[model samples]
Target chain A: MPVISYIDAVTQALQEEMQRDEKVFVLGEDVGVRGGVFRATDGLYKEFGAERVIDTPLTESAIAGVAIGASVYGMRPVAEMQFADFIMPAYNQIVSEAAKMRYRSNNTWYCPLVIRAPYGGGVHGALYHSQSVEKLFAGVPGLKIVMPSTPYDVKGLLKSAIRDEDPVLFLEHKRCYRLIKGEVPTEDYTVPIGEAEVKREGDDVTVISYGLTLHFALKAAEELEKEGISVHVLDLRTIIPLDKEAILEATVKTGKVLIVHEDNLTGGFGGEVSALISENAFFELDAPIRRLAGPDVPAMPYSPPLEKEFMLNPEKVKTAIRELAEF
Target chain B: MGSEESVMETSRHEALGLSDDQVLEMYRTMLLARKIDERMWLLNRAGKIPFVISCQGQEATQVGAAFALDREKDWLCPYYRDLGMMLVFGQTAKDQMLSAFARAEEPNSAGRQMPGHYGDKRFRVISGSSPVTTQLLHAVGVALAGKMEKKDFVSLTSFGEGSSNQGDFHEGLNFAGVHNLPVIFMCENNKYAISVPIEKQLAGGSVAARGQGYGMPGISVDGNDPLEVYEAVRDAAARARKGEGPTLIEATAYRLVPHSSDDDDRTYREMGEVEEARKKDSLVQFKKYLEDVGILSTESGAELEREIGHIVDEATEYAEQAPYPDPSETYTHVYAE
Candidate 1:
């Protein structure tokens, strides 16, 4: 095992996948000789020719549409959107074409493509660069949405996403790319799409989180353990087909639930997860499901204090968990 | 004669083929397309079909360009009013009728889409959208993939002249030019985008002029002449195969009908202009040119029309008898996984 940053894990996964399958190619702005804005695709163009690691024009819609067309014609394309915020321009291609191709064509077609976009806050990237819009795609049927918080999971989940027989929105948290470094296996492995990993198990309360906020929940769980209030932390790697068993079982064991995410609180993906628990295991809950999320503001800001104030952290997660555990 | 005059004459007669049979075949397909529209119009009026955008006057341009394409390999992204092109590209009259009637057996959409939304992935006809210029980029995308894969396939995208005003038109062509992709952007300059006439929508006065900015060759053709459209597309396809990048082709044609079955044309255009455009009807021009070239005998033209009308009638019978898609199908094909 080698220690790798989350961004390097993404590059490694792409490089390995390209080497393993000749049909896999990467295209995005600055992905070729320039090696991507975040260096997630560094050395790919040099290792494989420019054809395999392509740098496309600035048009996000073209990049998405080209990937879709190529995927339909026997090639797996991984398109990067520089930042998740820029993906709005290509939303039509994602929502209309990629999401509907399987159903509209009556299972005769599949968009075996991956759209990799770095999202979320904490890097002072201001408004346009930091957004967690994975919630927007959670309800889309054909698209599998993945948000990995650690280097190891990013590598494994990315491989699974590329090999999956459907279109996937592989959203990487830009803020966690370099901040989180961990040991990742060099061998090819796949983290199942809809499974949740228990980062830290306890009996006091169950804390469910994903993407960048998973770290905060875990930290909160560890800190709360010192206060004798043990927290069971669940990291939902894939948001679309959520691991219902893990959620139900965790809520039943702890009898309390607290959902955390980096996206804004209202209409975030946490609402769906909370709703699922309420519908499935309502009587098991000792208290109402609590959700601690980023302030309902328009993403992150450049000002340090404003950015920090709007961001979800371990303190907020701990406070929410403490309140829930007492119930 | 001056060089420009000779060139114009040659360009105008570009439709003139070496033999009579070629002209007759072109005229036959145009006749087939015309009859299909006639049948579709009748169906809508009789309440058998919901709506139709009759490709009455623009048959020559659609048929000619489709004939120039390699139906087996080349891809086509046709707009809603391209029933004529759809027929030429192997879309059976039965399949068209099934789609027009919103039946399950329609291969284009399997009853998932409205009529004229042509989409068959197996045939390389990328699904079309109602958005005017969106399909232009999809064409460029297919062309880009074709170039990258080193495949011997060219993508032909057909859109109205008004689509040139869209950013997608500019972006698609610019990308194709920048990458030297094998694509042909065919602008069916039907003189209007609904009520907005050419002058009101376009400041450059001609759609072909927009192509000059992209560094690709641009050609203006008499869209009413099937031979000219065929020659222009053939030349453009050859250029694409030779790695000469994309070409912007403006087919100057006329729209003799309203925008769609739901539209009223009297609100938009002057009756005089509509009358003037009717004189340049593509079918009429092709028929007259066939007669002038001795390709169309009076009996042969009537015989072709009768045969096409029978085919349309048989297809309508089949479509009318075919059942609508089961309601359960609505939830089935939304996703493969």
Candidate 2:
């Protein structure tokens, strides 16, 4: 076991994949010489040549379209958008071309590619730098979505996404890129996509979260433990083929559910989870499902207090859990 | 005709490398395309197919350009009105009929899309999107891949004069120019974006001029002249194989038919305007050239016409007899796995 940060795990996955497959290559803005703005691809360009680790122009649509074309012609391309917000220009390619390639072609062509982008807020990154585009992309079929909050999961999921037969949106929370560290394996390993991990199991209530919000759920579970409220924490690593069974099973046992995420409370992934439980596992529930999420605004200000106020902190999760416990 | 025919005159003899047999073949295919347009119009009138875009006057441009490429090796990403090109290529008449009928056996779209949205992965022909210039970017991508893989394949992508105004078109040309990708961008300038003519939609004098800023060769060709278009595309494809960059070619053709079966040209333009276009018909010009060279007689042209009419009729019967797939077939081709 080796202690590694989330960014290092991403780099490890890229290095290993590129070494394993000759078709595997990286292309993005500032990814070749600069090694990415967040240092997620540091030391990769030096190891690989300019052909494999390419620095493209500031055109996200070209990056996405080229990745798809290369993938169609028997190459595994891993494209990167500097920020999730900048992916808007490439959304047409992602949704129209990449997502529909397999379906429209009747699966004769599959876009085996990965698009990596740093998402979420709380890092003083202005409005344009932070966003959660998973929901927007989730509506598209033939695409997988991955959001890992820890170093080990990042390495495993990134590797899995690269080898996937379909396109994947690999979102690395910019807030958790350096803050989270875990013991990641040096040997090759891949955590399966579309599976949820039970970070902390408890019998009282379940707290479902993903990405940066998973840390807050765990912290809230710790705080609630002092108040004699045991909380089960589940980390939804992938969002598209979301672990609906795990969610229903966990909510059935705990009898109370609380979904947390960094995205806005309105029309968040939490709503999908809450709707699933309410639809399928309503008979087993002991209390109403609740969602603790960020404020319904574009993004928060850079000031410490404003950022703190905008984020779903541990205390808020604890309060929500206590209130649900009384129900 | 000797080599001194650059002034665009009607010559007695046929051009070199263009036999009367080839000219008749092109004419028959164009006639078939016109017939398909007429059938689609009748179908729309009788409440069958929702829409139909006719490629009547620009048949020479499509057929001649398609004749330049090897269908098995090269790729084509054609816009909506390229039935003539598809016929000239290896796409079977039954394939076109099935697509037009929107049947499960439709080799192009499989009932998932409309009639004109053609695509065949085996032939390396990608489906055209409804969006105007986005497919131009896709064409660049395909060409870039071909170049990177060292494949001797040239990608030919077609669009309308209206699509040239899109930003994606400029971006695609810019990328192709910078990377020197193997792509031939053909602009089928039919003079009208539905109702608004070229003068209102386009700002530049000619669409080919935009390629000059991207450091690529931009040339204007006589769309009605089949030999001229064939020569231009042949040269472009050869240059692409030699690692030269993209070329923008604007073929100023006419929309002899109404914009679509739904549109009525009587409201916007005069009948004299269409009669003027019919005067410069490619079929009549090529036929006279072939007759002058002794390669074609009036009887031979009539016989060829009768043969193509029989083929189109047989293809229609085959499509009509080919049973429409059951509803359950809808879920079959959605995913391979």
lDDT per residue for candidate 2 within A39-126, as digits (tens), equals 8888888998877888887788888887887777668889999999899989888888787777676556668889999998888876
Q: What TM value does model 2 have?
A: 0.94
Highest lDDT: give the candidate number.
1
Pairs of residues clashing in candidate 2? none
lDDT tens digits, residue span B1-337, model 2? 5535544643322443655567667667776776666666776787766677777788889988988787788888788888878887777767877776777788766766677776778777776656666677777877877876789899888989998997667777887887888999999998988888888988876999988988899989989877788888988999999999799999988888888777888888889998998888777776676666556788987887777667767776777677666777666543236
Tens-place lDDT per residue, model 1, A1-327, is 799899999999999999999889999999999999999999999999788888887888878877887787678899999999999988888888888777766676667899999999888888888888987888888788998889989999999999988899999999888899999987889898878888888998998988889999888888888899999988899887789999998898898999998888899988999999999999999999998887887778989999888888899888999999877
Q: How would the docking of model 2 be graded? A: medium
Reference-based lDDT, each prediction: 0.85, 0.82
Share of the reference A-B contacts seen in candidate 2? 0.30
| Number of the predicted model whose TM-score against the real structure is largest | 1
Where in model 2 is the C-alpha error above 4 Å? Answer: B1-24, B265-267, B332-336
Error (Å) of candidate 1 at residue B65 is 0.7
True contacts kept of each: 0.42, 0.30
User: Candidate 1 lDDT, tens digit per residue, B1-337?
Assistant: 8644463444234444435665567677778777777788888989988988767778889988988888899998788878878877777888888988989898877888778888886677877666677778778877877877889889999999889998778878887888898999999988889989999989979888888998898899989878788889999999999999999999988888888899899998888988988888877777886676556778988888888888989999999999988998888855453
Fill in the DockQ of model 2.
0.51
Which 10-residue window in model 1 chain A sums to the lowest lDDT? Answer: A101-110
